[model samples]
Target: MTLLQSLIECLGPSNVLTDADAQPYLTDWRRYSTGCAVAVVRPASTDEVAAVVKLCAKYRAPIVPQGGNTGQVAGATPDRSGTAVVVNMQRMNRIRDIDVDNETMTVEAGCILAAVQQAAREAGKLFPLSLGAEGSCFIGGNLATNAGGTQVLRYGNARELALGLEVVTPQGEVWHGLRGLRKDNTGYDLRDLFIGSEGTLGIITAATLKLFPLPQTQHTAFIALPDFESATLVLNRVKKAFGAALTGFEVMSEQCLSLVVKTFPEQRMPINCQRPAPEWFALLELSDSEGGEHRRDGFELVLSDAMEASEIIDAAVAASESQGAAFWHLRESITLALAAEGKCIKHDISLPTSRLADFVRDVDAMLLARYTGLRMMVFGHLGDGNLHYNMLAPATLSKARFEQLEAQAQALVHDQVVARGGSISAEQGIGQRRVEDLRRYKDPVELALMVRIKQALDPLGIMNPGKLLA
Candidate 1:
């Protein structure tokens, strides 16, 4: 039998998609990276994945491991060469086990993030790694990307949440390391090796994720800070006052909020009216694992203190569940509104919390001087020091002309990020989108070591080729 025939026989024809049926897996969500693949194979279990990988190794065919395909960096999409077989792991969706005593859950790679969250909730737990794409993004993809969402401030990123991982090696060998131990001082951490490797090292088939007690009184509030600088001060004040209860702290500039109001009329401003809209807004949420109404009172007191200190000009507290959802809707709509605007140059960078305000101001100053009629939108997880700095072309500039400035804009912002001791790709891994940029900014020695590790793990260079290491 041919290579495709073997895959069909192993996985059954219903699971192995080809030609017209595989178009959805060929393109990325951003529609930025388009590629061709011989077939899109859906393996129902870890053994099947191993078999598929072994067959691809025999044929010398490359394998692009994909989950949900919701990654912004096009890490899951195939290349245009059509020499690759896309391995879709969604069919393996299953909660293998939930160790309530250990506070951990063993979940298959294909499980949706939102579904995992729901399962944990039903079991009286909270899987805190949350993002707007949680509904469709899979657990394996989250682990592959080491995704950081709203709760990174208190809990941590996807990397920290995972206690153990079961990966299928690039050589088609299964390495079962799913031990939910809190401390194992054993040799090198092989789990870390694959967590953020972007499938270049191995395919993560399952993971034992860490879970936390569900917050009893989760409170969300929207406050308009006085200026850009006030955001950091507000974050500091909340951290000092609320301590561990402070789960999230997000900041958004006036332009970012205005875009949402303009695009979606239903998402009117959350806070009551003032003389003029505050220059910036900060969204805060407090949560406690222990059940109590005092947690709610504490959050209210913090807002009062912030207002008294002149840090906030206006504020709105979510008194009910629907109100909290409405507040978050405004924050989530910013990205969708940006997409609606037009093509934009997006930079995800991290900096010291103290320097975030200045970075934004200085970057804007320099960008405005160089690129006339350029619009900027600033927002992101203020607590974690990551910013989604986006630049849009003014109407006078043509799309083709604006496209040419993408590289220059990336360099301009990244230069500032590095100077401030920050990272270019904060939460998002350096997939196809930032591979060249990673080369431009990453330390040579550090990158060389990573290359050595990749070579050691995938000697054939068939695992997700032409990604990460350049």
Candidate 2:
């Protein structure tokens, strides 16, 4: 039987999609990368995934493991060759086990991140791996990318939260390493090897994720600041005052919030009445074991000190849960607003919190000077030093013209990032989009080690070809 027939036989015709049926799996979330695939197969179990991998290996066909297709870097998208099989894992959406006593959850790779969070909540625990795409992104993809989200400040990235993983090797062998033990000193940390490898080494079939105690109360606040420097000062203040209770510190420039307000009239900035809006706004979240009154008193005390020090100009604490959600909606809506504006140049960068203000001041000046009329919509999780430094094409430029300028803009931003000792791709993995940038910016020795690992794991180069290494 041909490869397509074999896939269909293994997964059934309904699960094995082809032609028009497979189109939805071809494109990345941002629609920045689209490719062709021979077929898209939805495997319902780890055994089914291993079988599909074996079939692909027998045919010398490449295998692209995909989750919910909500990746920012197009890491899950196949190549233009149309010779690869897209292994879609949505059908494997199952919570294999939840050990509440051990504070761990073993879930299939296709489990939606939001579902995982909800399951943990139902169990009276917390899974703090959250992102804007959590509603659609999968746990497998989150692990593959070592996703860092808002709460990464306190709990840590996906890699830190995962105690174990069940991965299917490129050779079609299942390595059942889902041990929920917090301390395991094995010969080689194979779990860490595959966590952020972007599927070049192996397919992550499932994971055993770490969990935390649910907070008694969560307080969200919207604070206005004069500049990024003041934002950092406020961040330091809260870090000291709240200690581990401070869960999130996200900062957005006035331009970003303005775009949100303009694009969605229903959403308004918390401190919009000022004659001139604050240059920066911060979304602060505190998850406390204490009660509402205690959390509120502590939150107000810090803000009051910040105001005394002139670190923050205006602040609005959410009076209720709905109001808190509305504040987050404003922050999350910036991306949607940018998408509506037009073509954009997006950089997922991270730097030392000390240099963030200087990096912004210098890069903003450089870009505006070279490319007149460029609009900057900057925002990110300040606590973790990750910024979504995005820019929109000038309204005067045509789509084609704007596309041509993308490379130059990226060079300017990435060059500055490297000079400041920061990373080009922060939370987002180096998918097809930044493969070249990875080559240019990554240390030569480190790059060589990565290549060697990939070669040892996938010698045939049939697993997610032309990505990460290339």
Give the top-scoring candidate (TM-score): 2
RMSD of 1: 1.3
Off by over 4 Å in 2: none
- Residue lDDT tens for model 1, 341-436: 987788888898989889988999999999987788888999999899987777666767876787788898999899999999888788799998
Best-performing candidate as measured by lDDT:
2
Model 2 clash pairs? Answer: none
Error of 1 at 378 (Å): 1.2
Q: Candidate 2: how many backbone clashes?
A: 0
- In terms of lDDT, model 1 sits at 0.89
lDDT of 2 by residue, 12-113 (tens): 999999999999999998888889988999998999999999999999999999998887789999989999999999989999899999999999999999
Which ranges in model 1 have alpha carbons more than 4 Å from their true place?
A: 395-399
The alpha-carbon lDDT assigned to residue 229 of candidate 2 equals 100
